[model samples]
Target: MMNRRDFLKLACFSVVGTPARSVFDRLTGKDIAGPTKEGQPKWAMVVDLKMCASKPGCRDCVDACHSIHNVPAFNNPKDEVKWVWTDSYKNIFPEQSHRFVSVEVQTRPVLILCNHCENPPCVKVCPTRATFRREDGIVMMDYHRCIGCRYCMAACPYGARSFNWKDPRPFIKKIKEDFPTRTKGVVEKCSFCEERLAKGLKPACVEACTTKALTFGDLNEPNSQVRNLLASKPNIRRKAYLGTEPKVFYLE
Candidate 1:
């Protein structure tokens, strides 16, 4: 088995050494930015509900992901730029909820983000191809190409994409040099920390999770943590009936 260091080294090589990677692809650290097919290294995430529920008021993952990605804090829901945030259980899983459901289950804080679905509706509606699913199953956006049409946002069922109503740079407390801040009239959402993945690091949210509630790995790997967790534990995906084939799974 490859050690962590070795794994990271190989990851870096795969990210950098891949042939014909365009400038945008290099900038985003995605091998090839387009529709991903089967047999590729499909990225996925698994959220452990019990572990996350242990800390009722923790926003460590949200804060870390936002701070690193330059997600502006409008302090208003109308203009909030959220890469990751918690939601009520019922809102996230309406089919899983009932009046008889326990309060703990009803009000469970479920982390939500872009599901990076295999058949992303947002990708299909994008006239300019601003948002496309990478070969690794990561849904990514080209901010420069986004005409603020909001097609992707409207097509997205998860409400994952955030549009810049105005200049967002002013709202950021401090910008991380590693990532670019979006301009007005562009759409943005979680990229699963693709740049960090290129550096062989986990997503900021997953790493910042002290309770280890967030698990990320390639679903194609037989022994991957996410695959193992999915196999051994009962889990659910948001809106699975829609046939989007969401990659993010939640453990109950």
Candidate 2:
């Protein structure tokens, strides 16, 4: 009954603390362990709203992520690009809001980033495997393989995906030689700092957060910071009932 995507998710569930590439290798019988069913780390993020709510004007996290990732800024809000940004609580969590809620908290800008869900609908809908979930549980985008169909964007419920409407060269001030810039028509989103993780570094947003509001860690490890936060404080995930099982949690 398991489809290819389901098989990948199943493999991801058993691959903790291992290289992302190993997931594919095991599928091809390249690993000594063969196909594992062990509980592996589901990478996750935690946003401490109690700390982030006060620093809405401070965009260090956004700036760090964007600059390093070569994300261009078109200036127009409707056409602007973003990897991480801020928006009102009501706008981000419309379903969780109530009329009795205070205006300040309701209107307060909160940090918004990709959830990198366990069961990503975008991955399921991608015809070209442009977006797929790695065995380590990170949803990734292969821009070179992307065909610019926008199906992934339409499939994403969080509105996390963005399609480049115009050439980004003019918008990018200083282009990083390392990160590849996407041509117009490709969809992009937050990558959960997979590159940094490969080099044994934390995410740019998490490190740039002076208030220490951002926590990134392996969910499978009970001693991890994100896991500890979830254990001690009540956390909220966007659209939990939708069954996406987002890895990012907000500590309100």
Candidate 3:
């Protein structure tokens, strides 16, 4: 006789190979058509590391993103981050070795944010349609629809998502009048400035980058500036081993 857990696993696996339409119906109580446009704008980002080293205006990008998003500013690790952050080389990518004194990767702060993968595992794992991929290839989170499960956070390899562990209203200061404030108990990540994009503007972070380290454009467009930048510059993605095929690229 099959155990209950094993039986459930088997049942789920049975549906794994089914069409995405059926999967959507089963999970979301509705069927969503796959994207219609074959070559719709697929925005990707490239961070130029050479220009990022001790860069003067680097924080401007982060500040501009936070200012526009109405993200809370609580220092407590539990209630921090929505759009941008800084991570050291060692923290972002720890060296794996048996040697006791491996030369510390010269610590340089890298701006960290959501990669918005072409194939986001977060979208697949979300039981609610709270998190979904947009037609423009941007991964968006609908805070109102979220159930605070944090499954998307666990599924993401890049640690891009943050959860609201407590009420966020108190932490916000001088809130942006136009942006909606996020409530407690939802998973949030960068949206690549979808609102701005809709207004025919670049992401605030990209616009704030004085050194032009951040580049955003349609990866599907062969002649797009971002594609051209990638072609000309050697770039890499975080956690390539996971095969996420992240839209965000980094040029070192």
Q: Which candidate achieves the best TM-score against the true structure?
A: 1
Over 55-132, each residue of candidate 3 has an lDDT whose tens digit, in order, gives 743588888888888888888676676678777656665642233534443356677899887668888788887998
- Number of clashing pairs, model 1? 0
Model 3, poorest ten-residue lDDT window? 96-105
lDDT tens digits, residue span 28-111, model 2 = 424422232478666899998879877658889999999999999888888888889988899989987898988887987778
Candidate 2 lDDT trough over 10 residues, lowest sum? 28-37
lDDT of 2 at 126: 80
**Each prediction's whole-model lDDT (CA):** 0.89, 0.84, 0.80
Error at 117, model 1, angstroms: 0.6
Per-residue error at 131 for model 3, in Å? 0.3
TM-score of each: 0.85, 0.84, 0.82
Pairs in steric clash, model 1: none
Q: After superposition, which runs of candidate 1 have C-alpha atoms over 4 Å from their true positions?
A: 1-39
RMSD of 2: 9.1
Model 3 Cα displacement at 75 (Å)? 0.9
